[model samples]
Target: MASGASTKEPAAAPAATAVPDPKMPPPEKPADVRRRSYVILSFWLIVLLLGLPIWWMTTTIYRANLPLDGMIDWADGKACRPVFPLQISIQADALQPQEAQHLVRLIQHAIDDLNDFSGHHLRLQLAPKDDRRIVQKDNPELALTVRLKAGEATTASLDPHSAALDITYPSNAIPSPTSTSSPLATYIANELRSTFSEEQSIISYLLSTSSMSSDVRPQSLTPTDLAELDKRMTRSLRYAATYHLTFSLFADGSTPNTWDIEEAVEKYMRPLLDVLSPIHNFTVDTQLQLYATPGVQSQVLHKEDLASFINAAEWPLSPSIGGAPTVNFVIFAGNQTIALGDSESSAETSQSWLIPQWGTVYLLSLPDATSHVSSNILRQPMLTFGGHLLTLLGTPQAGSLPLRLSALTRIRSADLLLRSSSTLGSLARLSRSLPSISIPRTVADGVATSMYHLERACSNLGGLEGLMHARIAEEEAERAFFEKSMVGQLYFPDEHKVAVYLPLLGPVGVPLVLGLIKELKQWSKKRKEKAKEAREKKQQ
Candidate 1:
């Protein structure tokens, strides 16, 4: 017992000696431990409630609510089906009401047989036989009226001023009440079909080439027709309400620097421009380029030489300031004559040709010594250019100037509608595919404007109102799709995120987590001891 007590005493003495010295205040409180705990908690809270939310709020994309399903449906041809209902009037001046009715029925049957495309329907109506002549003079919208007269077998001819089909046919040919068809009806139907054949083919081609389904299209088009349509499409600019026409006169030497283009444009082009005002708005600026050189230096240009005639790099035919597309018509006055290829039989006249999607170039060959190109000298070239301008704008070849321009408006409206819809589709796809891109409020506003205009344009197609709405829709869609800030921010990548996190988070997180764990362990041990003491006291 004494040995055991002595050993125990030594142990107790060492333990007592091991007790903390009161002189050394409780080992300076672990400031780092407390600091680390606060740091960890603050960091976690910030990351959870503040940091993450700030990041999300700052970086998240602001995508405008788009009718994506509806847009897709439109693109897929499930939204609206296109139809053209043509109204043709018949005026039988030589016949009674019964005969006129019979003639109209016969003509309708004949037209039905002639027309293979179901989308375009021609309905015949009887025009009033009035001598007042006001209706005949005013109404051009009435596609055509058959003016039948009793005479020898007559031919079909369209009146120059009116949409009147003059047919002086034998009275015997008029269909009886019992008859369903007649020779005159067949002749009229054939003439009408021939007259509208080009338009029908063009519409059919447009429908087929567009995003619409193939089922809506008619039979396969001939290779020649397809080529023509492709040519037309290539030449035509994308639709816009306004067009900026830049008329430039480029000369190799510095003599003909000044042209009376302002006067010439006002005199010749202005009239045409005025006529086309309903369809397109025009702004013209004339410039004279001195010391300009052609891309090809050959004195006699071959067919290949034409491709390199305009030095695009040197030519200052930059697009205009406004959003409207710029079309350049250059009158290059030089002494050089262009030669057709090696073939001597080929005769390419006017020394002028059109550049697809760009403009027309006319080479005027004058005396080598002559300097100035006066307005009189420009008259012929300007006229040529004006004609080419119409072609370049995809105006139909048929019909009078006024009629062609009216058709142009309709075609352009359709073009703008399709383009805007396509742009909307692209924007939707881009937003869905690129999750990181930040969309701005401006984009939302533009999208809303675009959708509204698109709806309006779709509802009011085939008229001036449709053109206006389509133009607005196209502009808005382009703005939304090409929002500058959205594209600008893509440069800041995830690599940048990792780069920022490594330095601060790495060093700071370690100490904070370790302190938190230590505090938890210490608290747990103290709680266990207190519980044990309470149990011992109870037992006692």
Candidate 2:
């Protein structure tokens, strides 16, 4: 029994000896603890002083300041008011200088009383008695010249060729020096007002269509006049500095594909193009299309069919590669005739039809054997095209080519000015509506440039320089309004930014936070010990 107990005790001792008591680590030295503290503090300082700033700088987005108030003012049509001053010269070769001057004063008063629009004013001046010409050849700015002649009954007629009104008045109908009102003077005033009535309506229409105040709007437009004006405005193309005019000859078969368009354009259209060069530039290009089909298959096209005659899908009438608009003039060699019966369709009884804002299409009936067209065959077509081009350009129908071109400059300038103002207003409203959209420096610069040009354009209205300045303003406004960088930032939100930054910052931040906490605990322990020692010393 003793031997068995000894053996069991030895086994228990071996088992207890198999696992020794756990070893304990020695307390850290002061130098090593200080070193650890310094390392942790240095890392925190680096992160706080350098790393934080660098990360903030890299992650931040730059937003440039814009002129919101000024842009809004321009867009609201509150910044500039347009005015047109028309100068009329009265030439009374048959009367004395004093008499003509007196008549002019009376007529001016009558015109002023009849005028309703403040923006358009008419100033009358007496032409020199020595000048026999109806219109002052030296003064191109004269809107009209009145020529007085002695005749049977009081009559006034506008010269067909010049901007002159011929008035045949009886010798007894002349205004006396002391007479406050005369039949001759009243008649002349009425005639002058009648002559400018269309112009006034047109100008008033422009102002009303813009963002200007309604107080100055004219209410004299009849329903018929409004309908006509709407049709004309809708038919006219948008104002552009340049237009691409493409003359294409299309045929159902291969015959009569090519035409002598280049020569015809130079002979018939070159003079008009040169006259319009100051207002707009036109680029000419010609192409021959074979085996092309019209949009309508009817042999006899009705008045309603004219609208859908052109095949827009298959036709290569894309806008010019540059920023200019395209005007396509097509000549189709087909035997289609226009069905003409109603009086309403009489205006389109000819073989050609005008496509508003686009070009014209003339159906030229030719023999099946005809291949290449000569310049003579294209003469009438070119002439018709020239007239249609003027209409497409928004030229007044009543004026001569030169006069129409001058009117076109003023019209284009006003139109572009209004368009730019409207665009600026749109942009201002967009910015205000979307506060989160990031505006870059380029957009701000563009807005500044646009406003500068707009001010210049407003001051120089009714001149070639005004048109050029308005064009620049329009381009800049478009660029700033459609800025890509500003639009891109609107789609991304703050959550996306956090999702991208959290993974990278989390891994690096945990160890730093743990080290800082450990250092703070050590510092607290040392401070308590030092305070306890100082209190004990004081007690002793």
Candidate 3:
């Protein structure tokens, strides 16, 4: 019965019967296929015309219009030529007006003949005989005043206290109105030239250091002069409109920590600070630091060891929290002596050394038991610091503090002008060299501001206005060259860009490729069908 039932079940299972395949609705109609193609084409057209442009506009960086040619011209020194017209007033109260005027003409001619540098020239003007003393006070542009006096021999001496050149000439040395030249005239010209030689050298050095061609540079600088200029330049601090003067008393031990710094500064340094007010604004602060250690472990500090004795890493010599630069004047209480090798023995030598562009350090040897420093003890140190300050500020070593400060203003203006121009040139070159680097609108704005200020500063070269403009130009140029956005572009590469864009592009690109392939297949099919219809007609 079981075998019969299995046989019946096998028989119920149909042999060689094919299940019908599921029928497709039908081959798509030509119209329907064309409509589907149109839909895909429309989708891609929307993506290409609308989506791509929107994405590019939204993601791109903003770059402002820049005066590239103008900036390059300024940087190359083709736009402006710097000229210094120095006005000198001659005071000859001892002589008649006509005679003084004659002497002045002759001296002026002699000076003109002697001057080789066209950029810097001296012009002579007669001082008002009615009020000789008021000449400098009245004319702020007067660079020097020559006072004539009758004496035994023709001689010239610079006033220690004023910017006056005192000339003591013999009675016969005075040039007559008819004379074209005289010993007195030549002597005055030569003396004036000698007085300004150092200044001329400095200006020449500055011009040489700039981007200007050799045509504008003075060719008279000897190797020694250049070396001296380099030394002075390296020793000086960068120009700043404001400086923070920090007076610090550092002691290895707790004793001798208290100092009369305020009194000392008021008595000794105030006059200089007041004179320097026009060129730089200085803020003074005092501090007392105890248990300070020197960087060098040597008991006796040598000349070479002085450089590393400041303990810059450990010392509280941070720059002030404003735009101004800091100049530290440290007075350390220690027994460390600077040994002068192979020099004649002296009971006392210089107890101070100046750090270039930094400040002065005075090693004071005081009694170990002493706990205070008096103003009297600080007098010499204060004087030393004042002198060092002048050096650090690029003050002329030959002139009085007043004259040096005036020169400093002019020097700083020149420095800033060159610096701005050089920065602009560097930026231009960098832009041309780096095609991928992005320039922001802020950089363009800063460049424009710098150029504007540079123009103003160039127009008014030796005045306070020039200094102000130059300072602004330097700051703007620096800001533009160091734009944060510009630097950020360097970290983003092409691969990074591809990675960032791939996610959005992948889905859209796939649909586009598929639609294109479908359209090509339809076109081929239409061509084959048309060929087949032509063949059929021919056969019929």
Models 1 onward score TM values of: 0.80, 0.84, 0.88
Which residue runs does candidate 1 get wrong by more than 4 Å? 1-52, 85-98, 109-114, 118-124, 131-151, 158-168, 212-215, 251-260, 289-293, 297-300, 313-319, 339-348, 367-377, 489-495, 526-540
lDDT tens digits by residue: candidate 3, 350-451: 688888988999988898688999999999999999999999999988865555665677778878888898898888888877667889989999999999
Tens digit of lDDT per residue, candidate 1, span 365-421? 876657777778889888987898898788888755654665566567667776777
Q: How large an RMSD does model 1 have?
A: 6.7
RMSD per model, one decimal: 6.7, 5.4, 6.5
C-alpha positional error of residue 474 in candidate 2 after TM-score superposition, expressed in Å: 1.4
Give the clashing pairs for model 3. Answer: none
**Cand. 1 TM to true fold:** 0.80
